[model samples]
Target: MQIINARLRHQAALHSLTMVDGRFTAIQAQSGPLAPQSGQYDAQGLLACAPFIEPHIHLDAALTAGEPNWNQSGTLFEGIERWAERKPLLSEADIRRRVHETLELLIGQGVQHVRTHADISDPSLVGLKTLCALRDELKEKIHLQVVAFPQEGLLSYEGGLALMEEAIEVGADVIGGIPHFEYTRELGVASMQQVIALAVKHDKLVDVHCDETDDGQSRFLEVLAYETLKAGLGPRVTASHTTAMHSYDNAYCSKLFRLLKRADLNFIACPTESIHLQGRFDSYPKRRGVTRVKELDKAGLNVCLGQDSIFDPWYSLGNGKLLRTLDFGLHICQMMGHQDFSRALDFITDHSARTLQIADYGIAVGNPGNLILLDGEDDYSVLRRQGDVRLSVRQGQIIAQRPAAPLLTPPWLSA
Candidate 1:
């Protein structure tokens, strides 16, 4: 198969890809008078780039907003309480339907990689079971990585170890923890240690909700970095939503960056959730409940963006669209320059694949033939207009294609 006149992500000139047997065999310049091949796709100079990746999302509590009641208080605690109420009402069929629906929406937007954190704190373990099954169900179009996430805490919550072990034994790809939610700081450290040990034991990855708060005193990130570095596991560790880092003094953060860079840990920040759920307790200068994304990027550390919720208890607004995630990420992170906007797309694309550790994922000569063509000339145009995905190719086949939506026309308002 030959794909012609596709805009390159790394250059201005148009290029073509030769795909054979579900992999790109060659990428060369489109400077030929040769006749069109039998199996060829003319992109018409559209934007062609790597498939999008969703590095951090909660598939268990997705699309469950206002099940019993809404998060009226607008606090993380209230959201957790509301989710607990809805936990008992979960059934395999119910969870499967919503998750699959969300995945469809993601695929339409050109996302093919997702790392969803499913709750394992429930004694019934219904969420973990449902997501693990969904992993197998959605592998054809999307790569789903399920994390055995203890939403409450490992040490504070009862039967947490057993639940995590069960999740790992039943095919969890990662282990997750929330240290800030623990009852005490000491317990939080213990929980991080437990999660790291579990990851080592099961040979899985670690993605913890580390210090997701406004309190500057939280120091769980240091612990995670130290452990990951000591164990010689650098990129295998991910710290999601280190919001407290936003409040840290430069002195502390400067020191922290040393450990983070040495360990080469990945950072995943949710801009939508951070802007909404944080700063509720402050009065004068409300802090954004987000991490230092630009700083991390400048430090040469891997940083990715995420849509933490999609019409869920924690956040009421989400479309599961990675473009929206990138929009908020650029706005909240204050990365609005020309180069900033161009690289901001990586927050959901290349940088995210690194966070999830997706192998051979990009528009390369020898990479898999999983790519998307959107309606734009460059990353800036595609992101500013939120262009439609013209084509979605998976494994050397066109799985989905969408045309440009028609502009509304009336007799009086016709253009």
Candidate 2:
């Protein structure tokens, strides 16, 4: 396969790309003659870049808004309560339908890779079982990683640990825990320990929903970091939605920051959901409820952004576009400077790939032929307007394409 008239991120001019046996075999300047191939495409000089990565999402509970009832309070706890009310109603067909729709939306938005959490707190493990089947079904078009997430708690829920272990045995790729949601502080710490131990036992990755509350006293993040460091699974560990870090005192957070850096843990911030769910308790001088994105970047830590919910109990709006997530991230983080804007682009693309620990996941030779062509000239333009992806190609095949809009001219200026 040959793709002509392409603009790579580091190139000065449009170029051509060649794929052979699902790997990017060659990339040359457009000035060179085209090579013979089975197929060809002219991008019309559009920019081509690596596909976006969604590091944190809940596929099992997605697209479930207004199922039984609406969330009147619009708080995180209310969403959890509503989900608890709605969980028992989930069937295999119901889960498969929503998961397929969500994955299609993600693929249309240039997200070829995703890591979704499946609730395993239930003894039946229905959500995890459904997602594992969907993962196998969508393997050719989309890459999925399912986490055995204990949305309730490892010890608080009845038979939670046993069910989580069963999920891993079935085919879960990661182990997850909601430590801050445990009954007590001791239980929270114990939950973290259990999550790490289970990951080690199953040889799976660790991604924990740590300290997602606005309380300054919620310090499970420290426990998570300490366990990751002690277990020697730092790179494979991820801490999602540490919103409590924003409420902690400067001195304590400063100390914790040092330990987190030492752990080399990955951080994922849901700017869209966090901004909406947080600051509800404050009458004035409200907080952002998001983690220290700029601070973490400055400290050389890997920080990524996630559109945590889409038309679900937690959030009421989303279209699976990662660029929209980047737009919100820049505003909430106050990262509008030139350098910061460039880095914000990485928040959804490169930084997220790092969080997912994807191997050979870039636009380079000998890598899988997965890339997206944006309707913008450069990164600045892409983020400035939240540009659209005109084309999405996976494994040398064009899976999705957006038609180019027709050019319009004013009637008053007609020749």
Candidate 3:
């Protein structure tokens, strides 16, 4: 199949792409007759980018807003309590229904790769079992990665460590823990060590919910960095929601950055949830509750953005759109400069693929022909307007395409 009049990111001229047998065969600036074969597409000068990747999300609690009750205080702990009250009621049937719906929604939004944290602390393990089945069911449309996350606490929750081990054996792709939720700081650090050891023993990946509070004293990220260095597990480990770093003083953060770089750890920030769940304690000049995205990117570290919640107990908003997620991140993180727009978009696309360790991503020849066509002229326009993904192709097959909504130019407004 030949696709014509497509704009490759970072390149000015319109180009044509050729796909053969589920792989990109040719990519060059359109300079020839630009002939089309029997099954061809004309992008109409729209921006063409690699398929989007979601580095972190919680599939278990998705679309469960107000299940038992709403989060009145809009606090992180309240949300956790709500989820705890609701976990026992969870069944494979409900999880299957909601998860499948959510996956379809994401696929339509051009997300072809996703890493979702499914809570493994459930005594019944129904959520874990449901997600594993969904992962296999959605294998062709989207790549689903599951993390056996102990949301309650690794040490505080009864038999948490054992359940996590069983989850990994039962086909969870990653090992995850919520160390900050433990009973003590010592327990938190110890839990991270256990999480890393489990990852190494099972030969899986590690992504911990580390230091998600606004307390500057929260220094578990340093502990995770140390563990990463000691275990020689560099980029395989990710620290999600290090919101506490926003409050860390320059001296301490500088030292932390040095260690994080040496350890080569990845970071994922959920900007929407960070701002909503954090900063509740401050009276004035409250913090933004996000991580050091700019500093991390400048240091050549792999940083990505995630839609941490979606109509769930924690957050009551989000529509499975990566463009909006990136925009929210750029706004709160104050990364709106012209030079930062392209880089911010990469937080969900190229940068996220790196964090998810997707080896076969990108638009280069010989790579799988998975890409999206947007209603955008170029990268800047796409980022500025939060352009919609009009067409999504996976493995050289067109999977989703939505026509542009009608322009509602009312007479009064236009006049």
Output the number of the lDDT-best candidate: 3
TM-score of each model, in listed order:
0.96, 0.96, 0.97
Q: Is candidate 2 or candidate 3 better by lDDT?
A: 3
lDDT of 1 at 414: 67
Q: Supply candidate 1's per-residue lDDT for 260.
A: 94
Order the candidates by TM-score, highest first — what do you get?
Answer: 3, 1, 2
List the lowest-lDDT window of 10 residues for candidate 3. 30-39
Predicted structure 2: lDDT: 0.88
Across 1-415, the per-residue lDDT of candidate 3 in tens digits comes to: 7789898888878899889999999998876435556678988888899998888899899999898999999999999998988897899999988888888889899999999999987877888888888889878888989999999898899999889878987899989988888999999999998998888898999999999998899899999999999999998999999999999999998899999999999999999999989999998998999999989988989999999888999999989999988888989988879899755568889888888889989999999989999778766788777767999999899999988878899999997
Task: Please list the C-alpha lDDT of all candidates, in the order they appear.
Answer: 0.88, 0.88, 0.89
Reference-based TM-score, model 2: 0.96
Across residues 235-280, which tens digit of lDDT does each residue of candidate 2 receive? 7999999998889998997899999999999999999999989888
Q: How does model 1 fare in lDDT?
A: 0.88
Off by over 4 Å in 1: 32-38, 407-415
User: Which prediction has more favorable TM-score, 2 or 3?
Assistant: 3
Superposition error at 370 for model 1 (Å): 0.3
